[model samples]
Target chain A: METIKNLLMGFSVLLTPENMLYSFGGVLIGQIVGILPGLGSVIAIAVLLPFTYSLDPIPALVAFCGIYYGSQFGGAISSILINAPGTESAVMTTVDGYPMAKKGQAGRALGTAAISSFTGGMAGSILVVLLAGPLVQMIISFAAPEYLALMIFAMACITGMAEKSSQAKSIVAICTGLALGTIGLDVSFGAPRMTFGSLALYEGISFIILAIGVFAMAEVMRNVSNAKHNGLQRIHAMEVVGRVGISLKDWKLIIPTHIRCTLVGFFIGVLPGVGAATATPLCYSLEKKIIGEDNAEWGKGEIRGVAAPESANNSCAMGALMPLLTLGVPGSSSAAIMLTAFMILGIQPGPLLFQNHPDILWALLASFFIGNVMLLVINLPLVRYCVKLVQVPTELLFMSVWILAIVGSYAVGLRVFDVGMICILSVLGVVYGICKIPLAPMLVAILLGDMIEYYLAATIVLCRRSFVNFMSRPIVLLFLVLAVLVIVLPMLRDRFKKNKVQSAVDIIDAPE
Target chain B: MKSRQDLLFEIKVSVFLLVFALVYVILTLVGIDTSGRFLQGNAGLDPTTFPYFIGIVFTGTAFYLLVKSIYQYRLNTEKENTDAAKGIGIPVVEKKPFPFPVKASLVPYIAFIVYIATLRLFGFILDSVLLSIVILFYLNQKNRMRNIIFAIVFPVFVFLLFNKVLDVRLPIGYIFGAKY
Candidate 1:
């Protein structure tokens, strides 16, 4: 009853004309950003962070939430029409989505994707409301030791689970972030650590600057280079013929896939380090495995294939927010930027956020529900127009991105130094990309570094510097054990896989 | 071996990381002040403690990476030799080089630095517009008119949206002597 009342209050807060307009604007921009290849919600949000400084928390947050899931809706459009995913999370959508487009079922593919995304978002929002309260309640009593352990666990998971990067590189990235995080005046000592006498370094590198540099500017650099080499591939979007609405029969086929994927995606999203990119592929594979290759086309315009990933992607995005809102731990890169937004808005998200700022929490949740509906309304009727976003020239698009990144970074503190830092970090980002080093762990570490240090400091004070006393706390010990397991298990699994491959190769050589 | 270039890249990255970690540790030790003590006195952790810990761990991990990469490179070399001696055919995969050479990639960075340095003199709108045009032209030299138009219009739009509407004060050019 209280939850329902709170949700109503949230809806009331969000229903204002101004808030609604901001939400609409955010969604619209997100849709455009999504349609443009090489742009994602992370860059959009990071670039927009400086602008949000002037607005009230609620309107700013509402706009951000709209952009968050709005991109998911936009991503599927490109995936279906141009066979290019607007975001990494939308990659799986191209497999069946493009095939459907090729078969002149582009409308059907897009329709399924939009509806599934809406359903998944709505379902995920409901789950967030239900799950957030319980999760907060459980973690509200945690002390410094447990919080420290939890952060370690999160970092460990990110380092362990990062795709296509070696663990050593991930560790280096995380440490670099931690090192960067320590540049400012210490929270405890009030002494500057590594400012090197620059006042600009006193507050440390702004998260907004780092985010734009790494995510947006670095990406623009890569895209520009690629365009220079290969030239921008002119988009030939498939025609969206016929009605864009999914039929009742199509709905019947999609409903089950939606339910299963939402659940799968939500759970995966709740886990730190795993995100929609992981969830979408998993859901796609799960759908393929369940439907079986013989029964379904799998890759060739299967509606379930379209449904599974789209459903999972949006739900996973919502699921990533669960930890952010409840535990103050970001579950993904997008969530990390949102966490930064919350801080910029002077709102701290965590267990006490419900007690202290229930209005903000519930209103944000309500916006998700509202945003999903708005996305569906905008997506269904305007998809044909939206597909034209693919026709945007890559050179022009990237140039605008570079301008936005520069202006946004400069706007953060009105400092040319910040703008210069963007270039430096962008160069580093390019290096990291070239080396195949995962950036997520570094980002997460940077965001969490201060908090991790605070908790560690508090823990030291609480335990009187006794390691045994620190380990005596059951929750802390459990988290530490889990962290170790998270790190070790992946290593063991990789070793096993390598050994198995080597043995197979040996057998092949012996027989030959 | 096809992976020789990749191994060399990894080795270089590992060595860079190793040097970075060492420098990080040295900086933390020299730069951070630990004279002020907490409630626990000398036993209490200081601002440098976390950074030191991170630096040491980073150094260890980077060292591990360096050793691992060197071993992998040696193994790859041995495999290549074995394959060659056995007259075995190896598939040569064509790897796409990064479109921009090091020097070429540095051009955008240099342009950005110049843009920032000139922002105060030229102002946000003018500098941004000029930067946009240059970048758009660099990206594609053919679409002169379209690029020029877009370069002007978009920055003005962003300027109005940010400076006028959002109420964030963007710099006006000192050359024009325009006051907000």
Candidate 2:
């Protein structure tokens, strides 16, 4: 009843002519950003940030939220066609989606991705509108000690998601981030801890600089050392493609995977510090479980493979915003950036968001539903045509990306320093490509590292450094228990799997 | 054999960082004067306390890493007695590292860095022109005329977009500075 009334109120706010147009425009631009590789929502959002300063807070916020998710829908297009993930979350989508494209089922893969993304986005929005209230209350109930337990869950999730052989490397990268976070000045004590007496280092590193460097630039550099996947030319992407509807059998196979992935993505997205970059891989792995060993078409354009990852990640990506909208604690990296945007407008996002600012919140929540519907309506028909956008040649492609990055960063502060940083980071990104290390962990780490550490130190301060609060709390204990189970359960399952197979074979032999 | 090289490189970097952290710890312990004016916090509890605590943890982790890397190196070297990389089971395809369409990508990375460094000298317009041309060259197509067209058009477009419309100043280099 509460959700229904609120959603209805939200719909009323969205129906306004100006707000409706902005949402449509936001997603329309978002698709182009998605269709283009190396330029994702981060850069697109970064670019779009300055223009919205003139608008009222609600319309601006709604437009941005639309762009954020719309870009996600767009990312699936690139991955499905060229195997190039438009968004980090869409990276996993490419693993299966591109193969489908190669198989000339480009239409089917595109349709499936678009449909599943729409459903997943709806599911995630519903979670935001309804479930977020209770979730925040639950998250806030944990005392400092319990927070320590939760932070441990966050860390384990990171480790669980890390590429093996580089597991230690990921932790090292995180530790480095935690260290970098302390450089400007200690928050508690104003004394500069790591500034080394540099004038520029006093404020420490700018989040914009870090975001541009780690996410945008580093990724660019990493891409350079590799082979130019001329795979784009190979996928002719005829207009006739994307028309093949989902095969009935494929639908049956994928429906379960979609639900599972959406759940996985939504829940993971809801976790602070866990991001689409992490959630997509987790969903892909989860999809492997439902697949039959012999009949499963994994790694070769399986519908389940495409559906499970995209649906889950897109859902999860939206899930990251709930905490931001509800509690003011950012649920994801992008949400943190958006939170800053809200703060700049002097409209802090917190528990107060629901009650005091009903108009804005209503429009925002409505935009989620309306925007998602808009995205489906906007993206589906365009899927057939948008595939041709990638045919834009390489030199033109990268030049446009450079031009856009510069334009976006400069718009943020109009500071030449920002453009300078953008160019520097873009170059650095290419070099990082030469190194085998993935950039996602570094970007996510940079975003969450300081916040996690700040909260951690504050928790220690508040708890009198006591261990009892963590042990006493229900959620904290539950998280700890789950953390333990995740690490232990896999080994146990492997053992059980081996033993059961052995027994089944032995029984058959005995009858023989 | 190539995998052996990769393992060695990782081992080397890990060892180097571990050593760096250990040295930092030893120096800090022996009165390295880390408690500078900046580290001093009023009301007894200082910022130095956090730095020292984190430094100690970092030192310990680095030492543990050093030990782990050494152990891994020795174990891998012995187990691979005949020199096969511990195949994380990724079947290494015999494909050469850049088969034609691949090698062209490497140039842009260098050009990207070069453009950044030369930004002030060349101005945003000229630097962009150079960068786009370099990229076109990297793609290695016939028709210098097309490259010239892109080389000219790309920079002008970006200039009009960012500098003119957005009012974000792009460096015009020394030549434009004198003229203006």
Candidate 3:
């Protein structure tokens, strides 16, 4: 009853004209960014963050939530029309979506994507509301050790989940981010750690600056280099013919896929470091495996293939919000940027946020449902117009991104130094990219680094510097053990796979 | 086995990380100010403790990377030799050179720096407009008229949105000396 009342109040808070307008604007911008290739929600949010500096927390946060999921809707349009995914999460959509377009069933493919995305998002939002309350209540009593252990688990999961070849590089990236986070004045003491006498460094590198540099500027540089090498190709979107509606038969086929993918996407998304990028592919594969290859032609315009990943992609985005809102741990790179946004707005998300700022939390949750509906409305009727965005020139897009990145970084502090730092970090980002180091772990580490240090210090103090006492707490011990398992299991599996491959190769050579 | 280029790149990255970790350690030890009056024993942690720990861990990880890469390189070389000895030749893949030279990638970074340095003198609108034009031209030399129009219009739109509507103050060029 209380949850229902809270949700009702949330809807009331979100229904205001101004808030509605902000939500619409955010969704619209998100859709535009989503339709454009080489631009993602992360960059859009980071670029638009400074603009939100003047707005109230509820509207700003609501707008960001809109953008996060709105892009999922937009991503499908490009994938269906041009065979190019507007966002990384939409990559799987292209397999069946583009083929459907080629077969002149673009409208059907798009309608399925939009509807599935809506269902997934709505389902995920409901799950978040139900899960967030219990999760927060459970963790509210957690102490410093437990929090520290949780952070360690999250970090370990991120590092473990990295590509096998890039695991070591991921660790280096995380360490570098942690080191960078330690630059400012210590929270415990007023002593500056590594400022090196620069007053600007006293506050440490701004999260906004780092985000723009790493995500947006670095991406622009990479895209430019690729364009220079490959030369720019004009985009030609496939025509959307016929009505954009699904038949009852198609709905029957899609409904089951949506339910399964939504559940899978939500659960996977709840885990730290896994987001839609992982969930989409996993859901697609799971759907394929279940249906069997003989039954369904997956890559050749199968509606279930279109339905599965779209559902997972949107739901995973919502699921990623669970950790961010409940545990104050960002589940993905986009969530990490949102964490920074929360901090900038003077709101710290976690258990205490639920108690102190239930209004904001519930309202934000309510906006997701509203945003998902808004996305469906926009995606269904205007998809033809949205597909036109793919026709936008790459040069103009890159230039605009560069402009926004520069202005946004400078607007945060009105500091040229911040702008300069964006360039430096962007160069560093390019280097990290060249070396195959995952940037998501680094970004997450930067956000979590200070908290990790603070919690570690608190844990040490609480335990009286006794390792045994620290390990005595069941929650802390369990999480720490889990963290260890998370790190070790992947490595063992990789080694086993490598050994199996080697043995097979040896057998082949011996026989020959 | 990894290709020769991959091995060399790995070695280079490892060396860079090792050097960075070492420098971080040195800076943490020597640079941080710990003599503040708030430095009491009761405080849970001194400033350097966390950074020092990170530095050490980073150095150790980088060292591991260096050793691992060297070991992988040696294994790759041995594999190549063995293949050659068996009268099997490894295919050499020709790498395509990037259309732009290495230095060309640095152009945007340099332009950004110049834009920032000149922002105070040239003001927000003029500098932004100029920067936008330069970037558009560098990105696509064609569409000169359209790009120029967009370059001017977009920055002005951003300026109005930020300055007039959002109530945020953007930098005004000293040369313009114009009040909004």
Judging by lDDT against the true structure, name the best candidate.
3
Interface C-alpha RMSD, model 3: 2.3
| Candidate 1 CAPRI level | medium
Native contacts recovered, each model? 0.67, 0.18, 0.58
Ranking by lDDT: 3, 1, 2
Please tell me the TM-score of chain A for candidate 1: 0.96
Is candidate 1 or 2 superior in lDDT? 1
lDDT of 3 at A243: 84
Best-to-worst order by TM-score is 3, 1, 2
Q: List the pairs of residues colliding in candidate 3.
A: B123-B173
lDDT of 2 by residue, A430-492 (tens): 433433444444455554555555566666666555668545667777878876765456557
* Candidate 1: regions farther than 4 A off: A495-512, B34-43, B90-100, B178-180
TM-score of 1: 0.95
**Given candidate 1, what's the lDDT at residue A99?**
98
Question: For model 2 chain A, where is the 10-residue window of minimal lDDT?
Answer: A225-234
lDDT of 3 by residue, B1-180 (tens): 678777877899899989989999999988898675646465357787889888988999999999999999989888889999998897695664532344657667677889989888888889989988887787778789999998999888888998988886788888888443
Give the DockQ of candidate 3: 0.59
Superposed by TM-score, candidate 3 places the C-alpha of residue A238 at a distance from the truth, in angstroms, of 1.8
Candidate 2 structure quality by residue, lDDT tens digits, B11-44: 6666655665565445335422255654433333
